[model samples]
Target: MGELFQEAILVSILAGMIRIATPILFAAIGELVTQRAGIWNMGVEGTMLMGAFTAYFIATATGSVWLAVLAAMIAGALVGLIIAFMTVTMRVDHFITGLGINLLVAGLTLYWFRMYIKGRAQPTFDGFDNVAIPGLSAIPFIGEILFDQRLLTYMAFAAVPAVWYLLYRTRWGLELRCLGENPKALDIKGLSVSARQYAAVLFGSVMTGLGGGFLMLGFSDRFLADITAGRGWLAIVALIAGNWMPRGVLAAVLVFALLESVATHVQVLGIDVPHQIFLALPYLASILLLMGLRRQSRQPQRLGIPYFR
Candidate 1:
């Protein structure tokens, strides 16, 4: 127990929390944008899985992580296009469309993976490494944990402010927020609701794809089935818990990641508790957090409602 409180161990846990939180932060922020635009996209899980698989396949094939990331973003954007077509153009039920996307992507990725591998040895590729900031990384406890991180981690944190500014300070952002709250108002003002929604969904999809790509390139060496491992769903939970705000979503992701990091260290310390319990700790914490914060969640007024001319 004392080892758990040691400075080194504590620092490791904090660093792990940041590392683990990266993927969720990206997905949650993306989803926040989608939701803010009045779209309830439940296909984030499927989009992430597809992104992960695409990144892994491209990296193994061409040995270019950059290409892999690009391919993954394109794949995600394609999926987002389908969702936009169904909900915005076809007027399909948002929930049904999103769930269908999830199911389709899951089955499709699994089948494609089996066919591609053909029982051969799984291919591996070099992944991103931690880059230490010259002076910042030298700080005793705070430096190593915060400054020395993968490039994707830095990008994820940077996105929080960027997203905030885009949503609150930009004209396009004003239109998007208006679309979510009342598409009719925007429509009356000669704005194109469908066009703005399409753009928002595409942007969100790209970010979600990048999140999945990072998971593959920044964390694991080889591709695994469902590598996203429910992080997409967790991201949605964080989005709701954060009440659809960028900074709030980040806080939610960090809390969940911190819990996960603690669970991981408990196993590392050889605690006598059931491993399953530790595995479930982060998820349980998410549920509890959501319940506590649900009342405060102020979703966009038109969220999940199909906007029509």
Candidate 2:
């Protein structure tokens, strides 16, 4: 009986880990794309909040989850463009600019929510439904574990390979990488550095937007002020821990998710641990994970540095 209970406990935690990991996976992948272009966009947290709010409002207004997602992506893209215009096009410091964007988005989201949604926790709405993969979903423990996830979760996995191919296997990726490593080189080759940088930033923002929308339409059903809850920052760190590869990022997200799952399990089992400490586990673990590997990890050499012609 004891052994059977333990087995059941393990499986339940694994399931929860996958659930919590979905949003993290989405945000981390978005950050991965931005960093690969040599700029660290730290406004992801604010952008995510905006995405959540906007998706919620649209979903409430239209009664269409799909339209809410579309609006969220557009919102994120515009926010991304603002960052790009400030940093890439105008030659501002990427860090300072990103911070400003964060502040701006936070304030704006709140102000608008007050005027429109009247500062409610969120506009009430139903969220997306989970999906079970055919055939694969029935295959014992692993099958049930892996195949019975929601749509966004599957996309997060699919994004791994898709980003990998885009970043490492294509001509555009070649040029984008060149822009990151050596913008002058791309310019010398008659390519427009600012344009490529703009594209990278905006493109990265689309992912950020999707990550935020996933929270509304995919994971949870509502929004709160600063609803992203530092997951955006975690995603940035995840990009580093992932060694900046899509596959690596995915693995890192999974590991983080698993830690979060265990933390949740520890609480649920009524263990004699500080609830606050367990709550802090994911962030603390991320910091330790980064510190432990910082010496060995290699980041983009030109990261956060803007290039001038």
Candidate 3:
């Protein structure tokens, strides 16, 4: 236990926490926006998987990380469009629509991957490299943990404040919040509820896609089925645990990531405990945390309720 608190191991754990939390941060913030607009997008897992697969495919085919990222965003936006069409335009049940989308994406990506690889060796591509900020990175402990990180990590953290400002400081945000609380009020003001919902869904989907892309390009080398591995679901839980606020969501993601980092280190330290317990710690913690937090959660009144104007 003393060795676990050593400066080196602590720093490594902090750094790992930040890296592991980046992807979840992206998805959680995006979901925050979606829910703020009264749209409960349950297909985040599918959207993320699609994004991962699309990014992997584009990178392997063209060898351009930038193009791959762009493609993944587009793919995610398209998935959002489908969700919007069903829930917003068609007024289908939000939960059913989202679940269907998840199933569709999961099956489609699996089939597409099999077809693309055709039993050949898995293709690999170069991923994003970490950028150490000049003066900041020179700081003893804080610098390496915060300043020396992948660009995506920086962007993910930066997004927390950006999302807060957007939700609390802007007219669009006001309308979005109102949509979740009372779409009728916004409609009485001559604002188009469906349009705002569509925009929110699209924005969230793009962010989730980018999260998926980063998960692949920044972490893994080769594409595999379900590479997201339930991170999207974890993001949703974080969003809920944080009560759908950007900063709260960030805090939730960080806590989950920290637990995951501790789990990894415990295994490495060869602790005499069941490895499965450590592996399951994050999810178990999340479930317990959510159960404790859900009663206190201040969800939007109209959340999961489709607005029919």
Candidate 4:
């Protein structure tokens, strides 16, 4: 009985990891897309907060969660466009611009929240349901572990295939690579460098925004002050650890999620583990992953260097 209990507990731990990974997976893949195009947009935390706030507000006002999701994506795209124009077209310093955008988004969300919510601590969400695949749900332990999740979680899972296809199989993908690698060369070949970068940045930001909304509507069922809690930074690190590939990022996200989920469970279940040490697990893993892998991956030579070409 003791042995079986430990086995069940281990299975539960794995399940919890997958559950926590849902949002990080989305954000990491989105940042992966951004970095692949030679841009590092670090404002993901703020964008996520906005997404969360927007999703909750729209859901509350209209009682339509779908609309809230749509709104969050649209809002994210608009913000992405703004960043693209500044960083991609204007040739501004990418790091400074990204940092500025993050601060702007964070302040704006908080300001609007106070103005609209009348200083309420948080806005609530009815959120989405945990959906299960028909035949897939019945396949022993692995089935429930893999198949049952919220719609956003499923969407995050499905996105891996789509992202891989878009980045690897498409002609547009080649152009994006060329733009990041040698924008001047692309310009000489008559390809529009800024146009491609703009698209990539905006697309990346939209994914990030959806990730934020996912936290609010899909996971937390509410919005609170500064609720992103540095998860955006984690997403950025996951992108690096994955070497900016969709498939790799999925694994990276799962690993980090497991660390966090383990920490949360140990803390909540009164497992007698040092709370501080466990709480630091995910972050420590990210740092180690970055240190270990960065030496192996060679980023685009022109990355974050404004592309006038």
Candidate 5:
């Protein structure tokens, strides 16, 4: 009985880790593409917040989770367009533009949420249900952890390899990657640098929006102000810690997710320490990871630099 209980707890923790990693994984992999195209979007947090808010509003209002998901993507695209306009078209400093975006979204979402719920009880909706893969989900321990998850969770994990292929294999991907290392090379080839950067930023924001929606739909029925917490910033940290590679980003996200999952299970494990310590584990780990890996960074040379014709 004791052994079975321990095994069950272990499986639960691992399953939780995968679920927790979903949102961050989605954002990190998408942002990896954005950064590789030379745009250092600092507004990921704000974009995510906006997406969450949009998803919440739509889900409650429309009674359709799918519509909410779509709305969130739209919200992200709008935010991405703003980032692109400032950083790519207006030639503003990327850092400044991203910071401005974060601030703007934070303020805007707060106001909108307040007005939305004024004089009314908070609304709620049903979140996504896990879909177990037929044969795969029936496997002993591995199936429960990997094969039984929300549809979006599978999509999020699959995105890592898809992104890897896009970044390393295809022609358009090669051009996109070139935008980070040498936009001038594309320019010399008579390619439109702004176009590719805009596409990259848009794609990242859309995925980020989807992640936000997933966080709301897959995890909670109702929305709260700043519901994304600092996951967006964590995603950024994961990217840097992973040296902007897809596999590395996934690993970093898993580390953070595992820490969070462990935190959630501390009480069940009969640990006596303060819960706050467990809650802080992922952020603390992120700081240490960044410090240790900074020296080994393989960041793109032209990243965050505005391109000029």
Candidate 6:
């Protein structure tokens, strides 16, 4: 009985780690694309909040998770457009533009959320159900941890490799990468630098939005203000610590997720320590990891510098 209980706890923790990874993983992977193209979008947190809010509103209003997801992607795209316009067209400082967007989104979402629930009880909706892969899901310990998850969870993992291929193997990717390393090179070749950057920013925002949508539809029943917490910031840190590589980003996200899972399980296990400490583990780890890894970062040379001409 003791051994069985231990195995169950282990499985639960690992499973929770994967589940927790989904949202940040999506954001990190998508941000990877944006960064590689030289746009350092700092509005990931606000964009994610908007996505979650959009998903929650659509899900509750229409009772359709898929529709909510679509809506979230749309919201993300709109945010991306704003970021692109500021950084690419208006030549605003990328950091300031991103921070401004974050502030704008935070306030906008709060006001909308308040109005949404005003004079009415908070609404809730059914979230996604896990789809256990046959044969794969039936295997021993590894199966459940790896194969039984919501559809979006599987998509998030798959996105790492897909993004890798897009970044490293494709022609469009080469041009996009050139935008980061040498926007002038693309300009000299008569390529449209601004167009590609806009696409990249939009892609990242849409994915971040999808991650937010999943954070809502895949986990929570209702929305709350600041529902995204700091996962968006974590995604940015993962990109830095991972040196902007897909595999490395995935590794960083998993580490953070594992810490979060441990934090979550601590309450269940009734550890005598303060839950706040556990809750702070991922952020603490992020600070430590960034300190160690920033020196090794292979960041784009032109990243965050607004391109001209």
In order, what is each prediction's RMSD in angstroms? 1.4, 2.4, 1.5, 2.3, 2.0, 1.9
lDDT by residue (tens digit), candidate 3, 1-309: 676799999999999999999988988999999999999999999999999999999999999998999999999999999999999999999899988998999999999999999999988999899999999999999998999999989999999999999999999999999999999998998888999999999999999999999999999989888799889988998888787778789988998888878787878988666656755776777688778876687799999997876
lDDT string for model 1 (1-309, tens) is 577799999999999999999988888898888889999999899999889999999999999999999999999999999999998889899999989999999999989988988999987899998999999999999998999999889999999999999999999888899888999999999988999999999999999999999999999989888789889998998888788888889988998888788788988899776667755776777678778877776789999999878
Question: Candidate 1 overall Cα lDDT vs. reference?
Answer: 0.90
Q: Candidate 4 vs. truth: CA RMSD?
A: 2.3
Q: Report the lDDT tens digits of candidate 5 across residue range 222-305.
A: 887768989999899899888889999999899989888877787666677666786787778878877887788779889999
Error of 4 at 290 (Å): 3.1
> Taking the tens digit of each residue's C-alpha lDDT, what string does model 6 give over 1-309?
133258888899899999999999989998999999999999999899999999999999999999999999999999999999999999899899989998999999989988999969899999999999999999999999999999999999999999999989999989988888999999999989999999999999999999999999998998888789989999998888788889999998998898788777777777766767766776777688778876776899999998877
Clash pairs (backbone) in predicted model 4: none
**Candidate 5: misplaced stretches above 4 Å?**
1-5, 267-270
TM-score for all models, in order of appearance:
0.96, 0.92, 0.96, 0.93, 0.95, 0.96
Is candidate 1 or 3 superior in lDDT?
A: 3
Q: In candidate 5, which residue pairs clash?
A: none
> What are the per-residue Cα lDDT tens digits for candidate 4 across 221-302?
6667777887888888777777777777888788878777777767666777676785577677767877887768756667
Please identify model 3 stretches exceeding 4 Å from their true place: 290-295
Candidate 4 residue spans exceeding 4 A from truth? 1-8, 119-123
How many collisions per candidate? 0, 0, 0, 0, 0, 0
Clashing pairs in 6: none
Predictions in order: lDDT? 0.90, 0.79, 0.90, 0.77, 0.91, 0.91
Candidate 2 lDDT over residue span 1-309, tens digit each: 132258668777777778777777777877777777787788888778778888988998888988998888889899998988888878788889988988998999888877776645556788888789889988877765788887877887788788888889998888877766777888898988888788888888888888889887876776677688777887787787777878778877777777767766777777766656655666676688778878887577788898877
Q: Say which prediction, candidate 2 or candidate 3, comes out ahead on TM-score.
A: 3
Q: After superposition on all CA atoms, how large is the RMSD of candidate 2?
A: 2.4
Question: lDDT value for candidate 2?
Answer: 0.79
